[model samples]
Each structure stands twice: as structure tokens, then as C-alpha cells.
Target: MKFGGLQLLLAIALALAAGVLGAIAAGELRDTGQSQTLHHFVHEELDLTDRQKAQLNQLENNFAAERKDMEISLRAANSQLAAAMEDEHEYGPKVVSAIDEVHDRMGDLQKATVRHVFDMRALLDPQQQLRFDRQVASSLTSEPGE
Candidate 1:
């Protein structure tokens, strides 16, 4: 009975760890794909005037810095989560709090990325905006590698 209980607890812990890691991996993959799609659409698909290009360059630079900071914070949150899991060896208050922090960081990064996308879209002309909108919608809706 003791052994069975320990095995069950180990299984549950493994499941929780897998869930957390999977969520993080999926988020990172989606973020990378979205970034690549947008970068390609803006730089290659859309025809931008010199002024628009300059403006976009500046926006990209600023967003890059912000994105880096958010990513760093997210990494830190993940580290905390790992520590909590290791120290507690099971789901506990510390683990729950760390998970929440990770989710919050992910949400912050996602919101900032969406805002940056909108800011870029704003610089486009009507026709460009139409194309950009379609691309953005498609990127968001499509499955990974689709």
C-alpha cells in the first residue's frame, strides 16, 4: 500500500511536469512561427515607402528590446517553477504560485506582441493593411506547420 501510494504520487507529479513543459514549448513554438510570418509579410510581401520603412525600422528596434525583457522575465518564472517542483516534489502552493507567474509572463509577452503587430499594421496603407490583416488572421488561425 505504501509503495502504491508513492507510485501514484510520482505519476501525478510527472503528469504535472509534462503539462507545464508542454505548455511552455507550445507557446514558444507559436510565438516563433508568428514572428517569422509577420516579419516575412512586412518585409517581403508589403511594398513600403521609404518613410514607412524608416518608421517600421524604429518600431521593430523598440519592440525587440521590449520583447527581450519579457522573454527574460518568462525564463526567470520558468526557473522558479522548476525549483518549486524540485523542492516540493509535488503540486503545492509554491508550485501553484510559480505556475501562475509563468502564465502571467506568457500573457504579458503575447499581449505585447499583439500590440506590436497592430502598431505595424497601422503604418500600412489601406491596401497594405488589407493584406496584412489577412496574413495576420491566417497566421493566428492556422495550425502549426500548416
Candidate 2:
């Protein structure tokens, strides 16, 4: 039960495609879940004052712009990874560097997002903060679709 060269190549291609598609799908699902968690907690669960609402709106606008920039950089890093994978055709130095670059970009985005969440938390009153904290913890710990 040895694979021929063409069959091996086809299997490798299918595996790579599956990996890429899974990553994309997982990212989308995570994004959607995070968005819903934040939206429900901030907009519906908490009783926000007008002033707090205004401040949160400003924070959201600023974070939105920053997130967009980070997402663009992440996409560029992903492109570099793809190019490296294509050119190297193996787990080589360029591919390693590209993977590191992508990870760094992703870390940057995650850090910024966490900071933004804290910034929003800072505006909440004590009671609201309690709920917010719980929501954040739940979102972080819960399984998907929970």
C-alpha cells in the first residue's frame, strides 16, 4: 500500500487546501463569536448612561480604525507566507520567517484588541464592570456556540 508519486502529490495538495480552508473558517467563527459577545454585553446587558454610551462610541470608533489597520497588516503577512510557501516548496527559512511575521502581526492585533476591551471597561461603573468582567471571562473560556 505504497502511494505513487502523483497520488502522493494529490494527497499533499488536498491536505494543504483543507488546512487553509479550516484556518479561514475558524477565524471567521471566532470573529463572529467575539463580536457577538462584545455587542451583547456592551449594548444590551449593561445599563449604560448617555455619557458612557458616548465615550464607548468614541472608543469603538478608534478601535475600529486600529483594527482595520492591523487586519490589513495581517493580510499582508499572510500573503508573504503564501509566497514563501510557493517559492520554497518546503519548510525553509523564508517560510519560517513568514510564519513568524504572521504570528507577530496576529499578536499585535490581539494585544490591541485586549487593550481596547480594557479601555471600554474603564468607562463602566462598578456594577457594569462586574457584568462586563464576567462576560469577558465567559467569552474567553467558553466553547464555541456556548
Candidate 3:
């Protein structure tokens, strides 16, 4: 099937934008305190009490260390995949292994993130829990770079 020039150009532009956004997000996540940001949002947006805020902060701090370790593993896995790609030997097996490692690390990170959110919500009252649920739903629908 033949493709139109504009369609192909549009596809390429979209792919480029996705790559740029991914890189920017990775840098921000690596250098910034995302765990702190999560607590800040819950404190400011959920009208949490001082004690609840402290509890949330403590929870986030605990999760932050684990999350950071998972991120390191993910980065190392990605580096291994890149090395495998650039190696003189056949890349198929090495690349597959690295990708699987990345997936496992990512799964751990995602589990921690969800657990963090749940633990934070548990500290809130019923009203706050409802509001927090709505907040999470809206946040999920937010645009990139939010």
C-alpha cells in the first residue's frame, strides 16, 4: 500500500515529539523529588491535617528509597540493552534478556507507586478519600508534562 507524503511526515513528527517528551520526563524524574511532589499534591489538594501530612511524608520517604533503587535497576537494564545492540555479537538473546529485566524492574516500580498512593489515601478521612480519588482520576487524564 502506498502512503501519502504528509501522512508519513506527520507520523515522523509525532514519533520525534514522543522521544523528546520521554527524555525530558526521564531527566525530571531522575533529578527531581517526585516522591516529595506526590506528598505536596496530597497535602495541598486534599486539605489534609498536619498529622496526616506527616504520615504521608513518612510513607513517601520510605517508598522513595525503594523507588530510587528500582529506577537505578531500570536504567542499568536499559544501558545493557543498548550495549547489546551495539555489540559485535548477535544481539537477539542479550537484547531480550535486558528488556525482560527492564520490565521486571518497571513492574516493581509501578507496584510501589500504587502502594504509595493507597497508603496515602488510607491516612485521609472519608471525605478526603473521595476527593483524593477524584484527584487521582483527573490526574490520570492530565496531559503530558503536568
Q: Can you write out model 2's per-residue Cα lDDT over 92-115, one digit (the tens) per residue?
A: 899789777877877787788789
Residue lDDT tens for model 3, 24-122? 433334324233344556877777788987887788789878777777776666666555544423337875786577667666667777877898889
Estimate TM-scores for all models. Answer: 0.79, 0.79, 0.69
What are the C-alpha RMSDs, in order, of all predicted structures? Answer: 4.8, 5.1, 8.5
Q: lDDT-based ranking, best first?
A: 1, 2, 3
Q: Write the per-residue lDDT of candidate 1 for residues 53-140, one digit (tens) a residue.
A: 9999999999999988988887788778767766676679988998898878878887888899999999999999999999989877
- Lowest-lDDT window of 10 residues in candidate 3? 27-36
Off by over 4 Å in 3: 1-38, 88-91
Q: What is the lDDT of residue 17 in candidate 1?
A: 67
lDDT of 2: 0.74
Question: What ranking of all candidate models by TM-score puts the best one first?
Answer: 2, 1, 3
> Which residue ranges in model 1 land beyond 4 Å of their true spot?
1-36
Q: Between 2 and 3, whose lDDT is larger?
A: 2
